[model samples]
Target chain A: MTNQQCGTSRIAGCQFTLHPMSDNFVDIILSALDEVDSTKVWKDTDDVTTCVRGKMVHVFDVTKAIFLHAAKTGEHVAMSGTFSIGCPGDNEADVYMAESDEPMNLEKSQTIDQQAGCKFSLYPLGREDYMDKIYEQIDLSKARGVEVSASHYMTRLDGDVKDIFNAIEESFVAVQEKVSHTTMTFTISANSPSNK
Target chain B: MTNQQCGTSRIAGCQFTLHPMSDNFVDIILSALDEVDSTKVWKDTDDVTTCVRGKMVHVFDVTKAIFLHAAKTGEHVAMSGTFSIGCPGDNEADVYMAESDEPMNLEKSQTIDQQAGCKFSLYPLGREDYMDKIYEQIDLSKARGVEVSASHYMTRLDGDVKDIFNAIEESFVAVQEKVSHTTMTFTISANSPSNK
Candidate 1:
């Protein structure tokens, strides 16, 4: 099913659609996190981390450097993929694409039981060795530690469009400053059944 | 041979490189502009346009859109082709796969002279079409405008990275408000030659 997998991938301005699967994205994320670790990963569930999910259509334009950063940082649990435009554009698009730097799994699930930190595992690499350093730079002690292994899929937002929009902005920051030369842009659509 | 034509051609998110010969993109754009005859296509020749004479990249995801739109509009003029992502690592990628919209080119010419009071001699579909009353209900403009036609193979930008960044932000207003899905987010990096 080439569905979208067959579409051409550009390094510059790009667009794609998003579907908010609230419980849906949360579920996948939960499952992936659970598989990684337990209590150690999620401290008091709520304390494990703050989680806010919503449905949104993100757009991003990754410059060569940003693309290179994305390529380098392939499986970041926190990499935002919102689609944004550069200077010239008819309008901004609602799409997001990103690479994670970690496996996005619970690091210490042994004592955590079923609680897994809120981390979305995503790595849709059709090519090999495209972004490895991104994974190599994961810091376990960080506030939001993203693992680079386990289950990786394009887990999207579910409920709050506003939250998703904000997250998209934050994601853009990482790609902008953390990642270099990459220009990523985003546009979030309204809440509609079609989005999920 | 194939490089000579981007008319019917389309590319996705992959950044493309170009160089100008005796026929720089300016020449091509001016020629295309004078043909439009309806609107002021070239607002500012010196500032608005960015020439892709040498190899450049398309960081936007509009290849398929550009191809399909141009094909449907019958306005595509350059040599057409598609690109693919090559594997870089085992699970990661070195090159960022592009799913960007096609680049826009309000064609220009070196030899042609602009008609009086006519900013654009020809335009596949333009800004006005984008803002039309009935058309606002839906947008056929993407298929008709930069995503598809315009042969200059470029657009213009007055500001540097900040200007472009601001433009991306400004463009996102619609997506964030009308579409109440997930909040839209943007990540930016300066799209420059030196960095790449």
Candidate 2:
């Protein structure tokens, strides 16, 4: 998966925002940030979102950690994130591409207990059979034990937070194997009043 | 657009989640919902998201109003939503297809003054030249006076809340003119601590 072979850089990254449904949202957000070990990825926080760039595994590892950490606080939390790989002309984060694939926060994240409901859409850019790829991933999602259903423009996933995240991460990584440039956008909600 | 021509339904809908960064999030969310005029659209709220289905114009009108109303309260607010049209096998919402084009809440939404920062990704599914459509819309977004810039997995947009929503709505409708199945995912944030 070299840049030259795909005409797009192999570096993967995610830009995500966390919203905690509490007046103390700032505390929840900051505290969650404090718990995640993001050293393996190149991270920057801006006014709108925080972006983590590096190996695909590391990017998912850190973003998943941030969300799980926030959810463990027992507050209603929602995370919106976009993950991309094989972005054309995206060389700015190439330095992090050399980082190892080992995830720094997976062990800690696995211990968090929470339920999540999510909806996601995947774009395998430039593929004529994009629907086939999307449907394939949907099938995989159901096999992973997350309750799956079709909704307008996206797929709904419901289950334990860990299982839900695993389904998302696996499908994302699996799609990248065949498509050089792929991007997915998703929103995960936990402990919402509507759920009660 | 007819279902027979596109092999998909013409019904447009949006599933959205609004997160207000305050302990009184429930009040903020409910208050904003109360202020919106959603009579033109079919709306249903569940544990994770609120789905509004109807004519495209009304769908955007309601979602944009809810976000703007929440932002007007001067509290930090973020909205995550997916706007989709031409979804195959989505006949459940076909009843909304008969709604009028008139937007029910446009005039009132215009009165809200707030700045917003947003990131969005558009998917014109099953098109080989999908990138062209996406880049064209990026150009359109710029022409609308919103600050546009490329980011990982999505494009960043910044401007007054109304202008931001307008750019998004226009671009979304523009693409639907050429492609039958299109879906867009976006995140809009206002009054964040990071911005301060």
Candidate 3:
């Protein structure tokens, strides 16, 4: 809650909106949000969205809880969020990246592990060879010891927080030069309960 | 830029952060932001992120321009954003959803048809039968006239904006009743220039 409580601790922040397909969105959102652990995180809501801030574990925990809770209405709920950590001067988000010296235990990483992953897509404006560029970046990521899964529409990456981010950058820069129109969207977590 | 300009317009809002893979993040962010059209969209950046508000087309245009401009540095740049169009009482984002009566041209929708798509993964917490739950959701989506691609780690859905979202909700709710925890992350857009 306070900078002192989060002092040097790795914190994370996410802004999300829940879209209920069958109406009753307000009910679904309120009921789900009620389950969140306020002790571990901070939540702010407007008519359109909700923003949650806190430690990485708590952030992920509350997000998943609210989402699943909302889904219970069986109304086709779609929760979209943008999450981040490691932003400089972002006092609340600093905890997650503050202690970057620890190496991830790759051997023990699994769906059940308290690990995280990301799925993203790069849209290159007016370029016919976007795949080529994406591949180049993927190759660069492989060189950096990151694991990536590439499909026709997007790229999925999972591994150490540092390595995965490194791969994303390498891949992003690979195609950034030829075009002046590109858009990339991604979702990340500090601690993923499982690899879905 | 003003409330009047956004009146009755189907606009959208996205708050995003660009993580450049290398050390020159400041330069990349600044240059890309400069390319954005202030005439059409309103862009505000704090110490942590940038929030862009405007018409859907303009928002997409400015986002692409910034990403591409930043990518020119040939550094890995990952952009994370939360975008929405139809939330009650969110006047600014209402434009994109206000005129929802117009049907989408499904026949002309293609990879290059100024179309958009999204890929997302659902991580179910503390559950051994996660796949079963995911399959249940997928089945619910299939009944709704949507196309889905399911892999070991994630689910890929693509189609009309309405249908895609429909499928997302159906799929999301399918597993909501279980005693497990779940998290879903996704990337979506209305118009995409290229597939990467």
Candidate 4:
């Protein structure tokens, strides 16, 4: 079900769960999301988790805003998220991976250089050409100026959280188009602006 | 600095940060952690994140307690964690991975299902004998009743989270003894007792 919305989308996305510790945690999370500019992001929440699909900019913006809002209380909270750039059935195909791109937000992209890092693996699960597809996404990430450190199984990406997530989306989405059973798992961390 | 405290450790550990979406997030998270049976889990918090190190059971117990406690608030909170089984100079050695073991917690171990799952990869960087070490660990994990699903870069383990972590620790520690640098990354999820 590829909607036209995929055309404007460049980055893949993240599915996250926010486990609030307060008695009124739900109210806090929903309100924080409401305060962000979620124009290009698609959001859906169920009992287990919330999925945010969109460009890298909107996802990180919302995530950062949410963290900032939540941590301001100085209460204990936790978030679990899976960020991916590609998988089969992505609607926003290749918007960010294109050779030439319009600056989605020049100011945000320029000054947002706090490092966010992640290690992820794409499991194509017995696909013969999985390596080829995996490399293609890696190439796309490199093209977008992301620094990738590859290992035997997972790749580590270090850079701006926005750029890193963008690279993740682009790579994940690129491979998703070719593989049906691929599952990507990521553990990501970024330096909190408030903590800094 | 390897300390004497590492001898009592049965499993490797992780340090994590929770990003909440509310101002009172810290209160919420700390309260949740406090509610758990956090006997030996060493906890240290700075402005950026909280670090927890201890045996596998306590660490996972605290983590689950925190997630459940926080999620109950039904507000969005996010957590980022680094789970490691072995690194250079780990003192715990092969306590958990020992072929025949005293049940660390027989009651908890007995009630625990055999379906815990984790996907992990050991990144040896440029180690020449990386493949051999990988297989050795794979063989060791199989011996411990871990169902291993292998791929080009990573391996998937289906069994007890404790067993899985044990396998992870055993494998990681094995290679660490031989090589100076190796990092293992894992995505772990278990059937939540509280959730059920």
Q: Which candidate is the best by lDDT?
A: 2
DockQ scores of all models, one per candidate: 0.02, 0.40, 0.02, 0.08
lDDT of 4 at A63: 55
TM-score of 3: 0.32
lDDT of 3 by residue, A76-149 (tens): 34444544432222354343444333222222222222223555555443334443444454454353555565
lDDT of 1 by residue, A1-196 (tens): 0011111222222322111112132333344434432221111122111111111111211111121221121121122222222212222111222333222221321122111111121121221221332243322223232221221111223223223333433444343333322222222222211212
Span of 10 residues, lowest total lDDT, candidate 1 chain B: B115-124
Cα misplacement distance, residue A157 of candidate 2 (Å): 2.2
Second chain TM-score, each model: 0.19, 0.91, 0.47, 0.51
Residue ranges of candidate 1 with Cα displaced over 4 Å? A1-155, A185-187, A192-195, B1-84, B87-196
Candidate ranking (lDDT, best to worst): 2, 4, 3, 1
Q: What level of docking quality does candidate 3 show?
A: incorrect
Q: Would you list the rank order by TM-score, best first?
A: 2, 4, 3, 1
Q: Judging by lDDT, tell me the better candidate of 2 and 4.
A: 2
Best-fitting candidate, scored by TM-score: 2
lDDT of 2: 0.79
Task: Report the lDDT of model 1 for residue B79.
Answer: 13
Q: Which clashing pairs does model 2 show? A: A22-B22, A23-B22, A23-B23
lDDT of 1 by residue, B1-196 (tens): 0011111112111211111111133343344434432211112121111111111123221221222221222221221111211112112221222322223321321122211000000111112222122123323232111121121111222222223322332232232223211111222211111111
lDDT score of residue B132 within candidate 2: 75
